[model samples]
Target: MLGTIIITIFILGPVGVLSQSAENNSISERIIGGHSAAEGQFPYQVSIRVNGKHECGGSIISSFWILTAAHCVARYPLGVLLVVVGTNHVKLGTPYGVAQVFVHEQYESQTKINDIGLIKLAGRINFNAKIKPIQLSTSLQPPGTSCVLSGWGFTNVQTQTIPDSLQYIGMRIVSVERCRAAISAAGLNMPVVDTQVCAFNAPGRGACNADSGGPLVCNGVQYGIVSWGNPCATGVPDVFTSVAANRKWIAIKSGV
Candidate 1:
């Protein structure tokens, strides 16, 4: 049925990857209606950069491991990717080299299912009040749970102007059925599988481009990874790869 729809649904990561329909629309980027994060408020948040540009967000899962969306690192080589941590401002953080990247073998770009990935840092991170690993959630929070999303993605989609500092917003977990209905309402025939969860608030308030791979933390536990969604908020639920669904794979891959 999605194939029957004329309008395209965009991925929320690196640009140039087209939707299943092969449309020319670019990837979604940023967080809408978010507040500027304070120093050390989100210590686990990291800016994932490619070729010296901020392209996605990630979370520190361990001293040596980072969790993000698979689409964020699938196409890029290890050398070009860098992780910046321990600061609210993207440019002010300390940079770390990436030793390796592990994308979920089952990741499907078209559907964005199993869209999780892990990055091993070249060196062990020194944890402090400003830098620490977030605990991966072992279970999904119930629907209507409160959550927070943080990133350094663009605040304005039209101008594509990314903020220099981190931004965050509060959101509520959406039921899978509600999420599916919302997507269907948007005219997309894509599936919102059990391995994924959804979050949303009001219109013009949700994850956007470049916010991909960021953590969707519920009650301080890292529960989801920003994967894809309706571009620029628009009231549709923002879908995320469920962390609990892939916890075993993550443990096997990163031992985190």
Candidate 2:
């Protein structure tokens, strides 16, 4: 658990927004590429949609709660915050539950800081192999440990349409010094806030706009939430609001 916690903290930290890139530009290519974020068995591997339209991905942290990006909440109205669970293929199936989306009181879409949100479901989910909450990490990520990221974002950055299957890739945590160097080079003042950590693609794969609000899951634990990217997993560094840094805040806010 300690090893995993260290790994996750290292892999996620700092700014991201909508993206268009060479990695994945279209939904068809991503689906054909064989990577998607909705696969696997976990009570919380969830999906959210607004107004009957799929908006982005997320995870269920509690039987009656779902967690995801703050930007996602800002992008959509409170109309229908659909929380889908289990069954990877989102196209065909019954969802575990439906919920109302609520953004963190301090969540600011413009700043992309404290980018956290929750969904209160109308009913509780029955835990099962295919449906279970992912383990959350309270341990901070140590630089360089590898962690895994999964999502249904475009195969690359420029593509449209979300992939039908889930995609996953492994990455290493970026040291604070390095993550800061990357951010500084971009001309933005490095965040002084201590509760954040950073990560990027090990070499090839990366995250994009479609991947925002996703989980930076590692070591069987969810250590960070996808918040922002400067270059959208490209040249500019990406950032995540470190979970270990805000575990107590989340628990208290969500009443977990």
Please list the C-alpha lDDT of all candidates, in the order they appear: 0.78, 0.56
Score residue 163 of candidate 1 by CA lDDT. 81
> By TM-score, how accurate is candidate 1?
0.91
Tens digits of per-residue lDDT, candidate 2, 1-256, equal 0000111111222222213222321111011122444445434566666665555667778888777766666655555556667766646434644546667777654555677777778888887777778777889878776776666555543444466666666656776667667655555543624565566553334554445566777778887776655423444345666777767877876776
Candidate 1 local lDDT, 1-256, one digit each (tens): 0000112354332111122221233336468778898889999999898888888899999999999988889988999999999999877788999999999998987788898899999998999999999999998899889899998766776676678878998888888888777776665667889999888767766677778889989988998898886666666777889999999999999987
Best by lDDT: 1
Error of 1 at 231 (Å): 0.7
